[model samples]
Target: MNRCYKILRTVALTPSIGPSSIKIVGAQYFARAAIAAGEFNSTRDYASPFDADGHGSHTASTAAGNHGIPVMANNFNYGYASGMAPGAQISVYKALYPFRGYMSDVVAAVDQAVEDGVDVLSLSIGPASVPSGPSAFLNVLELELLFATKAGVLVVQAAGNGGPSSSSILSFSPWITSVAASITDRRYNNSIRFGDGQSLIGTGLAPPTIGGVFFQVAAAADVCQRNITAGLVESCQDADPFIRSLVRGKLIICTYTFDFESEAATIATVADTISKIGAAGFILTMDPDIGYEQIKGATVTLQVPRVILNNMESSSALWEYYNSNTMRSRSGIDIGFRATTRILDGREATYTWSAPVVASYSSRGPDVNNALLETADVLKPTIMAPGSSIWAAWSSNSEGDQYIKEQNFALLSGTSMATPHIAGIAALIKQKHPDWSPAAITSAMMTTANFSATPGVPILAQQKNKLSPTTPFDFGAGSVNPSKAIDPGLIFDTYFKHYVQFLCIVPDVDDMSMRRAVGVGCPSKKTDWCSDLNTASVTVSNLVGSRKVTRRVTNVGELDEKYIVLVREPFGVNITVRPQVFKISVNASRHVTLFLVATQTANSYTFGEMVFEGNNNHVVRVPIAVYVSSTLGF
Candidate 1:
């Protein structure tokens, strides 16, 4: 805890009614553990600011961790570690307890954060499922976030780690900046070299020095007890004492059945058994359905060398060698393997085409909450950030429990890791532009984000390691570029009233509940509820021919700047802007009408974008998505 405090001076450890003037405030533990232990928590506890789970520490450090601290994971050094905004102070709010969190506690924490005058709120937590209709009001956290934005605080949230699945984003409130997880350019590659000169690449986070001389190889089934069940033995699940003698000096080969329930446990059991029996090494084989993309394994300190073979062909070759006559005649087959790794240290290399892709676990979105609203189908995951295999500060108390070792730093992956990166960037933006509204700050970040890190190469998804084109639903306005975000020329701005109008338009949202959420009543003229929403991105679904939408933008750059409108029309759709070019004075605002006309009847969704390019090199880009209905008429 002291080490973390060194990174920032204003870190609040406990909730206090200290001077309201204080800029940063932290509440250690807002939620108490449930009476019964579940997957995320081990026991019940009281409210405190301390992080016993290590997640809070990791996220806090990622946001504003101290600069120039050497970090390592699984015995591999990753050089110095620093947060996205190392100079920014952080207020730690510990709303998450162990693995579980109570909505009441989360709401209380947000109240305290707002009262303490925090400029930015970073929440790496959310509801477990999609929020829509009346259930949306039940989201106390988001309701509090609405109040926080009203109080001039920018809230950044995790997009949830449920991805490769459409409509998986849970944080759908347009008032909050939802973040998705993306891969960094750096990756840890662990390879295995066989005696026959056959080599295969895989993923692991153990020490790179776990390779050497060849050892005898034996299948886990061959070494299991005679009385053991065929199913259990074939899966290599249990590490019984009887099988220890057989695998004592050989490399154990284990196969995964791809059973989601038992796959993880099976791998752990095999690794534990190998360590106990003093095996030279272990080789993990994937099911045919698992695919060839190497899955990042857990970070562990292993006594023996271990490598995974994600390719079916490689696993087949090894199996064939193990079952060969030469190996049957002997006690076990001789095998050669080496596990080595290289660290990129955060340098951008064009030769590497695998990174900056959407992580398979990072959530996708179409903003399910907006499905019920006629005009307000908002896009989610305001932006993407590097979240996979991130190294950050870990709680010393949680060492060896949640973390692999008793160290102040650890490597982790999730949207939880991505949220703080945006939060830190938000902090910088807030510091630079203190008067900017939360929506303006979000607009700046969204409009200025880069679609792809490398020119001409579309951002890819990590699932198949392919360069397939992704949608705004996959990555909203693209990945965040902090440098560009700091100076977005024109920002799409909104206020609490706009969001309240948005909620009023929600099909089933009650007026009383909406009043409680925004502390206001629905206006008498609510006809233009959705059209009144001013955001950076535009989405229009079920369009037959022509549809018009209005967008208001405020010039935050130089006075009397002219921005030429550039439109990339979606397939089967022609977008025309009235008054093709516009000029705005400093701090002045302008509204533009966009006419989206379908050139031909279409049955699918199409995507395009509009770029407002200024002569001074300041560009404000807005993504446009249109879905044409196959039906001819309404």
Candidate 2:
């Protein structure tokens, strides 16, 4: 794993595992485990830094996995595996355990990582929902992250996968870079062919090819137990002897019944039953009411060909064929099977229908933190990354793992997969510019992100597979462009104190909680609220007429550089910047005030952008969103 990731340091903080178990080439290793596992929490365990669950290794390797390692899955070589920052080094901190980890253990890990002087912290875990009130302040993870940010460590966290729903982002704190998942160019497209010359498209992993092999198909209902209970045979859940006898040497069709959906219709359960009964193959049809939509990836590995038919029309036709009179008179219907094909040799293609779309499960936000206060609600998923079906290094020890077969590399998906990409990018940026602050690095990435791959077309969403316009809430500051980010002419930077001030402006958050969070008291003077925040993005809510927002930009480019402000005003809103053109010397900064006037009240949120173009072709863009009283409730 170290050879693949170019790991600089491998640290083990568990009592059970040590440095010897963690194999890394040319990497300094360290171990520090708290021996008193039960002292911190009852759930705590003294485990080794070795990744028993395989998640830690996956994420770590995704961030800095070594370059040019052969990538294989299910004994099929796909390509070479490399991380986003393969040149960068990784240092592991074993803070998690199988399934769960104690909060105290995680805090200890964070404290140690910060103390050890790591450049960037990639945490793939988060609460399912935003914590409220004092709980928010008391959250050990958030508090530790605050300290890390204060110490100039770039913290990247997963915007939890509880998504496809608005306000589902869990890492709500503004100090950390919360990432959302998006589909990459690569996908596993499986095809199913029937004897009727009709073919259907589906998705799965390691589906057996079975090259033109034709087998007789039978519905599970046709192989019911004699005198079976009502609905038992139809559900196809039990492994009864009669059902097994009927299914042996035949492809079985499984459909979702009420009992199956409620009790036994998972992919694992269905696949296990089919394998145990000696079925030649399995065809899983979607529930009729749910309509058509193929499950995107593999849920489990199967020895036999397994195809999921999500299209309602195709599945309905198959169901009819299974119960047809011709089939009833005969022993069973003949079916032909073909395995999924890998397009572009499983390489990513950005311009295709599936490319550059937000993963259906990626979290969305108009961050629910401080939801009651219009000014305090922050935009989350600081950015999107390639998170779907990413191929990266896997733990060798975790054989028979559900996510990773006995291979050096595995394909996985989640915001967890996306967070490390940014972390690795941050590490690269840090290497290029050692003096840059975390906020400056964040601004560089955000201000220079590409919103669309093609001209006049915004990035598409994977779930809808359409080119619908998305908002900042959908993809905050668009997607990260590492090459452009390294030389962003100007950056909107903020310090820890700025966040404290912003928090102070939040309604219902008391000073006591603020002190507990930042270890600082609110200033005597009132903060400018959200207007004072110098973020790369601008948001103004509940605007009745006009409001002035102050922002400062620091020039990080050549000396004597001049930047001209270009405003794309939101609909019904007039935007003007005082001193539209300004000059700044290297290492110098300038402040600009934006005067916004609402020409008409907006019943919904409106969006625009301000572009600062430098003479040298360096551009820094800031997205602007405005909401009127009618839309303030959001």
Give the winner by lDDT: 1
lDDT minimum window of 10 residues, candidate 1: 1-10
Q: What is the C-alpha lDDT profile of model 1 across 1-634, one tens digit per residue?
A: 0001111111222121122444234454454323222323334333456666677778877887767877855455667888876766667766555345556556666788788777777788777665456556435666778888898888888888888777788778889899998878665555666556556665555443233555666777667676776556555556663367667767677766655243355455666667777776677776676654534444433434666666788777767666652333254433322322221112111235554888888888777644454323677778999897788887676632432446677777888888888988887787778889989999999999988657776777655455467788888999899999999999999998888877776666667876666667888777443534788998775576667788898999866688899999988887899767877899998898888777766654678999999978888899887777532433
lDDT, residue 404, candidate 1: 46
Worst 10 residues of 2 by lDDT: 1-10
Q: Evaluated with TM-score, which candidate comes out highest?
A: 1
How high a TM-score does candidate 2 get? 0.84
- Residue 201: error of model 1 in Å? 2.1
Query: Roughly what TM-score does model 1 have, to 2 decimal places?
Result: 0.86
The digit string of per-residue lDDT tens for model 2 on 1-634 reads 0011111112221111122434333222122223344332323332455554566677777887767887765666666777767766567786554434455556677777777777788888776456554356346677788888888888888887876777778777778888888877665655566665556665555455355566667767666554776355544556763356566877777765554445434555666677788876677776666553635335344445677666777677776665552333354432322222111111221235644777777888766545464433456778888887787766666632543545566677888888888888888888777888888988998999888767787886644433456777777888889999999999988888887777777767668877776678887886665556778888776666777888899998866688899999988788999779998899998899898887877676788999999988898989887875531222
